[model samples]
Target: MTDRIAMIAVDWGTSNRRAWALDSDGRVLAEMGDGEGLLKVDAGGFARSFADFAAPWLTDDRVVPVLMCGMVGSKMGWAEVPYIAAPADLASLSRNLYAIAFDGPARIAIVPGVSCIHDGVPDVMRGEECQVLAVLTQRQMRDACLLLPGTHSKWVQVKDGRLDSFRTYMTGELYNALTSGGTLAQLMEKGEADPEAFRRGLARAREPGSGALPHLLFGVRTLGLFNALPRAGLSSYLSGLLIGTEMRDALAWSTARAVIAVGSPRLLENYRIAAGEFGLAFEAHDNSALLPPALHMIARDAGL
Candidate 1:
């Protein structure tokens, strides 16, 4: 923990923020995180908010290098960094870093997000681009599909070590909204996972005539009411249904031969299960691989 710090790597997003103090060799020396997301930090309060977590590094005499990614570079972040167009790689991302002029000795750089025009519609991502780079670089992958699952799941394609295209799904958000209130929530608790019920939900999503999700979601309540699904395990069923639909939608856009799932164990397992049910190939990746090396590469390339 007392190692000489080389750089501060940060992953700041909408709901939370985390930072790591890395040594000269890109080894993490210490780490910290807080729930003060972009939404919680008030207007013109980014510097103050950041200092709360990174104060120890932002000293008077040391020009501690800091590299940040995610929503921290968005319009609502400390600075509104523009998004780098798609068909980009680590080089482009590093080149477009938005440097924040700190009055102190800390040198701050924010990684730009990625954007693309898909089928005449605009799509954007704030944080997952870094994760994509980390995976592609570490695996020496030239072309592949990468999935970062969370509230807003992302399906990204990397070609020739560059990010080519991506799409987002609100699977987790929809699950939260549906399970937080209404008839479904009333009958459900944070139930122990029922693998059978979960499979049933996935099956429902894949059914030949299952119709749209609105109708399928309504069936969750009906199944509970009719005792078709146990009330205690209704939550898992809803989760499977949403995740299944997400996979179904994403399959159409993903051109890569196989998909790499990147997230926590639970998240990766869920996506793996869904991918399996869909008969799609999947590989689990360590989420920890996303930040440290990616930040180091960017900082080194940028001459930080």
Candidate 2:
């Protein structure tokens, strides 16, 4: 690749797509964002979408090398890049990447997602690896636990800047399903993050016992029905239950002292609250802060 070659890094998930054109130093030269997420675009129209967003950079002698992560590599995505199992470094991830040609002028590379088998459970992650790589680049820790809060939250364990293992929780998805789905959906009003109710839910989740979640959820519903819990607090209560349960499960396997959470401010704030409720120390890093560093790591690993 020539020094003039523009490198584009993309993070495409289910609902949104982001692209950055970077110089050799990995500084963002130009950026584009759109709602043409993998789930929303037709497989055949991927090239068109790529061309439309990247047309400006494709001119002249700039032969762009595009590196993408997230659902773009999923079975339901443009192309399925098979996963690289855990205990992986940037090199391993780069080696496992799937490349395909677009009839367009640019060269495209899709970063393969990561997966791992732990005690017979198959775990998978897409865009979070970039966040992990970004964390390793930014911090000097020898070992750490990174929590990525989103629709599918990931608790990743890293040792010496390499991914050791991780787990995924369906916290956000469950929250959405319960809020938008049938009968029980009408029981609560949304749009408020009630800290008090959240705290109450967190306390209930921290109680000792393996099977307390179901009973607790039942009680939440009962409280709503009997005018015990305010309708406005129901959303926060449910959020706490899901996140708190995740915290319980994450703490079971985590041995790291410090936790770095990556996500939006609202999500990270919730994570901070949950961590505090669990007596764990944590620092929140916005997901966008990791983007440029992750692109640099991808360049380094791919020798771009």
Estimate, for each residue in 46-72, the C-alpha lDDT of model 2 and write its tens digit: 888888977777864556778888998
Best by TM-score: 1
TM-score for each predicted model, relative to the true structure: 0.95, 0.94
The residue pairs found clashing in candidate 2 are none
Worst 10 residues of 1 by lDDT: 53-62
Global lDDT of each candidate:
0.85, 0.83
In the range 1-304, model 1's lDDT, one tens digit per residue, is 3338889999988889889889988888888888998899999988877777788766665778899998888877889999889998978998898999876667899999999998899889987888888888878989898899999899888888899989888988988888888888887867678887888888888888788999998999898889988887788888889988888888877755579888888888877888889988999987765788789888888888
Model 2, position 29: C-alpha lDDT score: 75
Runs of candidate 1 with Cα error greater than 4 angstroms are 1-3
